[model samples]
Target chain A: MTLKKATAYRLSDNSKALLIFYFVIFAVMLSFILRTTLFTSSNYGTLGGLDASSMIFIFVVSLIFAESFKMLQQNGCSRKTIFLSFVYSTIILAVVMAVVDSLTAMLMDIITSNYESGFFQIYQARYQSMRSAQHFFEGLLWYVTAYVMMGAIGFFITNLYYRMGKLLKVLVSVGVPVFFVIILPILSNLTGGAIYEGIKNFFDFAWGFSHGFNPYFSMVSASIFSVILGGLAFLLIRRAVPKQ
Target chain B: MKGIEIRNLSKSYGEVVALKDINLKFGGDKIYGLLGRNGAGKTTLLNIISNRLFPDSGEVLVDGETAIENDSAQRKIYMMGESNFYPEGMTIRQAFRWSQRFYPSFDRNLALSLVEKFSLGLDKKMKSLSTGYNSIFKAIVALATKVPYTLLDEPVLGLDANHRDLLYKSLLESYQEHPRTIVISTHLIDEVANIIEDIVIIDQGEILRNQSSEEMLKQGYTVYGTAAAIDNYIADKEVIGFDNLGGLKTAYILGEVDNIIPPELEVTKLNLQKLFVVLTNRRALK
Candidate 1:
């Protein structure tokens, strides 16, 4: 009962922001269609890769920790309940948003000949070779896991920062992106591309780019990634106390 | 056994200990005053009972169920803490609505009545409320929750006298209507002394006294006299505390008052506030 109510609260609390976000996305799409029809001779496609945008949006949403934890605790929920409710609600959020993005992408595909998405940009050629037309179910399945993976990563980062002090938080926030963007690349150069190849090869297999463009493998790997992060986050949440 | 049982519950932050090997119980269906000085572990204990904090040792049991991370046990308890735990953007009406969702037994009509009585705006967000109204808002929801065990920490932190009186009266009326366990931790002892049925006094993380309020009061008395005689009179008694005003003096003694008062000296009941001050005061430890 607690899990149900808390998850319901988590979803409803975030529904307004998500509604506004979709409103903006559709409004932009409307303006594009209207502009080309009214003012221009040719229809120029609006390439809004909504799946990636949804991933980023869910990531930011997962970063909401302090206030949600406080609210759940005030509502007489235990830490375990809070953790379960969050993971469950985010999974639901990721899946529902994936459905919206997939349908919207298909809708755009039907409306404009020039319309394209990031998913198509990555796998359209491969999918075309494998099948006749765009696969709705396959795209949705992959997007669900991908978005959940994004949410899990965001939750892990939020919990990691919550456990750190002021100085550590600053150092880590600056150091992590710096390490990934600059230091890791420099290290790869020093290692004669072994590190880069290892990463590329791993993703190729994990994302099933090496396995005949099989999306099932990618879904499995994404689920595993999400589980790993969510499990680690549960450890942090277990002993987490509400701080002022 | 059917109440909140704390066994060897201790918690610390680095070198500072908030609670120290505290073992106590708040029995069912009574108003309890959890008295303590500032930094005296009252809030920490309440937080632990409500699963808001993790104790370094021991555990809290609610009706024989562990409270730490136990949803059922936690659901039976609610702590209206000094700090706001509800989200900042939530309006009073939204909070009340959510409270109903969280606690099925929540009294919606009572909450609405409280809102009108307090003259609080239903649409005002928590951040927009004045300090007094903020306390009032929190108090209203807590009173409406109707949980089995309710811990109120500084329930009237910023209320005016009239508001405080109204809250107390409303609280008593509520209790009369629906009896349940109420543990109130507050600095305002005198205001709550009359209404509280039981007293649990904590001093520096230790349980100083735990008993019925009426019985606890009967164990102590305060005597007023001139300096010379009072000084002589208190030497043989258990002088928990004393005060001096030039040549006149007052002594707080802990024991039965079997004998009649001396002709030169006067005696009165030691109210909860004065008793707490002397009992927790460092000098009174001797």
Candidate 2:
């Protein structure tokens, strides 16, 4: 409907602002990573380092952007429209970040490698020393995986916000996740190494797209989980009765 | 005939029943005053009719087509809910834009005209606006949507007397230009008495009274005289309510007063506000 489009456009304005904000923050962080030896091309000399940082970065940005999606729905925009709009915004943000990060990484790689080689070759050769095709596909999968999961989390939060009792709406909006954050680490510690290792391994595998670590399977698993969780969340939000 | 027909509708939130076995039909080119006391399911019923909520049983038909999840039916009905559902950061202009997108019939020019008429600042953020202004913004949207079946639940909430009057005028003007089924649920019966064609009094989730305003008025009469005289006249009659001051008394009695009351008694049209107070009070007592 026209209203849905209007809602989406209004929301996209805010989304665009947030996207820019994240872009600036990550760009600055990329500058810092360039100056640090830990992230340099010479260090580790594998796709693992770049993949890890990119996946983590994508995940964190997705989490923050989830807030923007929630704002869209809260603003009298329908949940279904918001869900649909989010897919587009997420992809847009992903593409923007991919371009910006790659450009910055390429520039930094050129300068650093050129200085190390003692040759002022125009458009430094090592700058074009890209990861294998497998790694590129893995990175793409990881990006989509993280974003979809975050979008699902966004829907989940919206559902929880509606399901909460009147008094709990405001409190739970911030409090529930905070409570979980405080509990999860303690629970992991108490549960010991096997559980901790499993959790760590899961994240590692989920983010391990650059090493040809079964990108399709990891993404498919994440997508399935996301769909199931997102569906439940949609149901909850849809049937929520506004309480006095 | 172009109106809403809700049959055997039931809704409950947990153990609290909002509506039960509700059957109602609201016709076109008419203004219906959906009067009810608080928690009497007026909002709940309106929500269901507008497709904001689902019923546990039965169906809501608009022109004989199920309204639930039916886009064509939903497109015809525009609802302004009691609660504030507008986003916080949006300005009046932005809200208008959003409404225009959702309702193809939404008249942006009309919305803008209302904005000007109301002297509302278009760029002021909703969160920054006063509660009254927030309601005004939504009222403007509802009026401008120009949908066939418009249901306004407490449309004048937080509005000042001047704006309320303006709203009534604008509503009447809009209806005259494009006649539709307009149902208003509000406590201000007297304020809307003149414009309301029909009245539906809901009490404790039951339809206590539903009839034409003229018919409803005709069914009851008010007698004013000395306390003793009024008391004597209504002694065996069904008195809806009575008010006494010193020796003066006014008693509203149900049914015709033509042959029952004394010829010396001063009989007059029952003020809808007073009649509602009496009927609802009587219903509550039962």
Candidate 3:
């Protein structure tokens, strides 16, 4: 019952925001299509893809952690219940968003066929590069994995803020970037570029893992990162106290 | 057995202690007034009971079961705290709807009726409501939750006299209709003096006094007479506080009132507010 209520509450809270977001996205796309088709000499049918979806998904996830967590806890929800409900809600949101993105792509495809110039379906044609059933399912997997990874990162960051004291918050805010931008560079120079090589290699590996031809590898890596982040978030939430 | 039992509960915020090894219980289906000054750990205790905050030590049990992270145990409890926990942009009606979803026994009809009685707009968003209405909205929810143990921290905050009176009447009416343990944490002692069955006075993070209202009132008495006579009468007893104006004096004595009265002195009942001030002030003075 706790899980059910928590999920329902989260869904109710965010559903309106999601709807407005989708409506705006659709309106923008439609307006661009109309302006290009009617006013331009040549039809350049290009709709900006699901690139904005990831950012929106991350914002939604952050809202869940930053606000929903405290709200639920204050309303007698246990940490375990909230964490579980958030997981379920995020999954449902990801699936729904992915399906909507796919449907939008298909609709764009239909419109592009009617136009003299083939539509530049950014997400389907450029990003996924395929329209087969297998590719669609793979795209779905990518979308879900990307959403979960970003959502987990958001959740982790929010939990960090929620649990940290003022001193810790200030330290983390200033110290983390300073360590990477200044201290790490100095250390790399002093270490005869060994630290730089290590950092380069780590980024190279991450880039390869994410940009791999086989989407499954990227999906697996994203899932792994999501699990680590989600696990850390759960730990923080378990000990989190509501704001006074 | 059927109420909240807090044992060895201790909570501290760095150098400051919020609750200090406080052991307390709210038993039976009686109304309890959790009286305390500001920062006396009233809200802290309620938060811990509802699992919004964790105690540094000890545990809270509901009907003999641990309430910490226990869904079944927490289900029996409801708390309308000072903080606004509802989602932003949520209307009063939506809050009531969600409350029904969370608390299975929540009475939506009663909540709506209370909204009507209070003249609160159901469509008004929580953030838009005035401070008093915000409290009234939560108070209405607490009254309609139908939970076994309801903890209200500063439930009447920002309320005017008439609204507060109406809330108190509604609370009493609900309690009469459905007998349940209701703990009201507020500074308005006189307002709730007659309504509350038990009084739990907390001062400086410790339980200063915990007893039935009648019993607690019985422990203190005020003697009025000439300053010299009052001083003589309170010489042998524990004098909590005293009020003096020229020759006339009123001394708040903590103990049973003497059966044999001095002809010059007048004895009266120790009101809750005066007694609370005296008792809590004694701690501050120390």
Model number with the top DockQ: 1
B-chain TM-scores per prediction = 0.89, 0.90, 0.90
Q: What is the lDDT of residue B132 in candidate 2?
A: 79
Give the per-residue lDDT of model 2 (tens digit) for A1-244: 5244633563465465556655765565456556554555555332213323444444444344333443333223444555556555555555555554444444555444321211112112223353334434444544556556655665566566657667889777677687668766677778875667777777666634333444455567678777886777767755554442
DockQ rank, highest first? 1, 3, 2
RMSD of each: 2.7, 6.3, 3.7
C-alpha positional error of residue B269 in candidate 3 after TM-score superposition, expressed in Å: 2.4
Q: Pairs clashing in candidate 1?
A: none
Question: Candidate 3 chain B: minimum summed lDDT over ten consecutive residues — where?
Answer: B83-92
Top model number, TM-score: 1
lDDT of 3 by residue, B93-140 (tens): 888887887788898888888999999999999889888999999999
Q: How does model 3 do on interface RMSD, in angstroms?
A: 1.4
Better of 1 and 3 by DockQ: 1
Question: Model 1 reaches what TM-score against the true structure?
Answer: 0.93
> Which has the higher lDDT value, candidate number 2 or candidate number 3?
3
lDDT of each: 0.87, 0.69, 0.82
